[model samples]
Target: MSGDLHTEWARLFAASLKDSGVGHAVISPGSRSTPLALALARVLPATVLHDERVAAFFALGQGRASGRPSVVLATSGTAPGHWLPAAMEAREAGIPLLLVSADRPWEVQEAQASQTVDQIRLFGAHARAFFDLGLPDAHPAALAAVPRIAAQAVLATRWPLAGAVHINARFRKPLEPLPTDRGEPWRPKLAAIAKAGAPRLFPPKPAPDPAAVAHLVEAVRANPRGVMVAGPLPALDAPAMRKAVARFVRASGYTLLAEATSQLRFGLEAVRPIGAFDALLRAPDLRAALRPDLAIEIGAPAVSAQWLAWISGAEAPRRIVLPGERPADPAGGAAAMLLGPIAALLEAAAVDLEAAPPGADTASAASCYAASWQAAEAAAWAAREAAAGPQDGPLHEHHVAPMLRSILQHGGTLMVGNSNPIRDLDHDVPPDAAPLEILHQRGAAGIDGLVSGTAGARTVLDGPLVLLTGDVALLHDAGGLAAAAAVGGPLAIVAVHNDGGRIFERLPLGRDAALADDCEMLFVASHGRAFDGLAATFGLGYARVETEEALRDAVAAALAGDRPVLIEARVVAGGSATRAALLAAMAKAAVAAVSAAK
Candidate 1:
């Protein structure tokens, strides 16, 4: 169990992680990190990823999927720097991650060693906490502090708010497990301490404040026209919170508006949440008609621009935000921030609402408000279905959503990319679709690490894993193809190739006729390259689909296979026009339906 002081110290630290319930580790190979990497491999399921950035995001996906911190080990200096992007995402998303960076001794660091930088507090505000475990020592006092440091680091990742924690371990010249004469007497004691393991940690759960609950109940009573807005939530608690929220909506008689990543969007058809709210809200008439007197927002801010705009106007509804991990009031319009377990708060509110009796007029108004939202929801979906073109025609990005829903109908994990993919899925996928575990990096909302993150999630999750990303995002993380191969799972990457960033076309800059050339040159950054050769280089299965049927079959076959597959759906550039057309049709139809219902 021990070769040198560094070996013993690293083993003790790794054992503490296991004791604190860390189950997985992602390692990037390097010399300085040899001891910690070897130690972690012994106690947990470890994967070696060549790229540190990819490894960090891979660990991020694991944390998001598993609801526990996954260890990410890298050498000192710039290796840990690569983790900054993923760390920022983890912080914003409330995912737990443990980043261990190995460094040179203090003297060498002072002398400006080759692979050493100021590893202390490297992640700045992005990390929940930072620890610099100075040079490894075998003194009984020093060995005793190892487990304490590990415990504190792991706890910090989850407490107050879930995010990442950094531990910078500095080692002497012999970074390997070579024998040394420094700590011969402490060997048996160190082994015993490692064997005993650190004490298991149980974090306290925050309860809903009685005063806040009473205030929310009174607000709901006063405002019969209320709506529950469910945005992106922590994956682990989403299921429980979904049930609780459904109970609250029924008790309070409010319509539910759920985003795609909200987890409440699917599996709650009984509650009948407004599935097409993004399109429905686009119509000014409908937005005015459905203006809620009170809005109960849970989880992070939604991804829909229309939703944000609707909620930001002068007549915006009073927002009661139940923040998870962090405050989610980006519009700065929250009337109340209920700080506690969201499910618990919702459950408490539901109980209070059930106990109170509403007047007949209040009951009638709430029922009518919910009914109007339902009519608009139905109309929006009807319009989208009516506008569907022939399946055999040229592929468009709009087709990916329903095609994916059909492919993964039974059960699977769907990781959507940032750009148009997530937005499309949010607008198109309905509540009737089978419940699939949807994952996205909506924390920072960037398109950098979709492939590697999905691969990482595969290591922890069961069933087939599918990543629906754009061509540009796929290319950005092309190196992650190697990670997908190494992890070895049924991962189907559906890369929607629109030649470039088609999402930019929807913005103001793309709409300007004079800026067409500039938009194409800089904003879109079109790279007309096929992914077949890239797949071949990584030894992954490859398929190119241009028709709806082909896409369906390719995804089904890819899921059927055990290895990773890249299914590129090549569509013409500028599909945003088609998206705009569909939205306009949906909005018009929704307004008409709402007016008729009234």
Candidate 2:
């Protein structure tokens, strides 16, 4: 007759998740979630991470790359609690993450017993959809709804938009189905179940509405001098949406400034992207000159302090944010929003904008305006070049970004660890460098999961994988290396060994004398501990490179070998003092150069 309902429930859950197109399952170690965990691990290609927070973010990264929901599994109690930050990020970033957590059963939790707490709605607003799947049963309705519940969870995570969905699986144990418990019916029944497992689509993407297209085109026509800003875009399930974004930007006769995380930064032969806009916007004169009649931001707000300030200062009448999954103003400055799927909107607008006659003076003016911004961007970079002082000291912390761009092969991913590494990328990554795919935890922008997340991405990405992080960030999530070592992927970390939280040195908090007393020990927490021992502990290849050439060589050699490697580039991090001074000089020079421009 029927086996453990918990086993059947979990098997059905995994079946429907796989059926609904979830590509990967990232499970954490826990006793309560044993049945579901084992079922999902066996059914789907699974990765087991020790930390729930790291596992969730790693699942988040996998979602980013694959454009599909990755299941993050955890046991009852504080384990599910750790997934909140990543869940919040998934919601805001528009990445679909399905959280499969085993929760305490009602009877156990009712007594307020050990390892039992109320797990209902634990993630608060962070989860886009929440389901408390009651304790598994062999009842008719429940058994029938098992696959459908799994399929519905898939729909909920990605439905009208994309984000995190929480499935709190409450299990009454006899968690695993003992092979002997099945009696004599096992063999033939298993053969029949295997015959029925097939992939499915719970809900596909929406179609383009003609009315929505008209409104988008009309909005663009009204603003002839619009500039396109591409920020963090959602992980698109449709591949066509990917190409459509670039084509739309290119055909719009508008200048495009894309953030590194935006994914639109690459495949830009059809369009010359403004990678230097963050630095260029630093020159007040250039930012003012490029001020448009309308600012059409295609994605979310970028990670550029200069751009954020400049765009925020522009009059509200000039701001037009493309409709997000949610209706709120991400930029806090959107005057209006154009409604529709971004793919459909961009595809429709591309055709309409291209067809609009040259007789339409607005179209011609838009082209000239785009070209003018391009020329002005070149001038700003020229000023930055002129402002550069000779670096006779050790390889500057900023140089690692440009150097790694060459080492990672085409179609490779470079996930930037948070703090100075990402900011440096935003400020000075060479414009001529080949556009490698870049990923960032720009959601919460935390340093907690970089190691684990990088390890997660290597599961899906076939090319050379690298993590560009600093000293402190590495130490913050050092425990995550256990997962990395176990995953057995040849990973490379271009670690900038700046001992302390040196990122603060550039801000007023570091420069201000009032805060100098605690600046060293409290704010920065400088530690001169060695890294080789840490590498050995984690079974990672360790190389300390003193010169830029040696750093490059070490990174290449490490990537070529079979083990996970840590290539440490020694840099004196005085709170980014050197970077701050260099950028200031460049902005000053850029101001002088653009002073004559209209």
Backbone clashes, each candidate:
0, 0
lDDT of each: 0.87, 0.73
Error of 1 at 103 (Å): 0.3
Q: In angstroms, give how far residue 285 of model 1 lies from its true place.
A: 1.2
In model 1, pairs of residues that clash are: none
Poorest stretch of ten by lDDT in candidate 1: 1-10
**Maximum-TM-score candidate:** 1
Candidate 1 has a TM-score of: 0.97
- Pairs of colliding residues, candidate 2: none
Off by over 4 Å in 2: 1-3, 179-201, 208-212, 234-242, 314-317, 328-331, 360-364, 389-393, 518-522, 592-598
Model 2, range 552-579, lDDT digits (tens) per residue? 8888887788878877789754537767
How much is the lDDT of residue 449 in candidate 2? 72
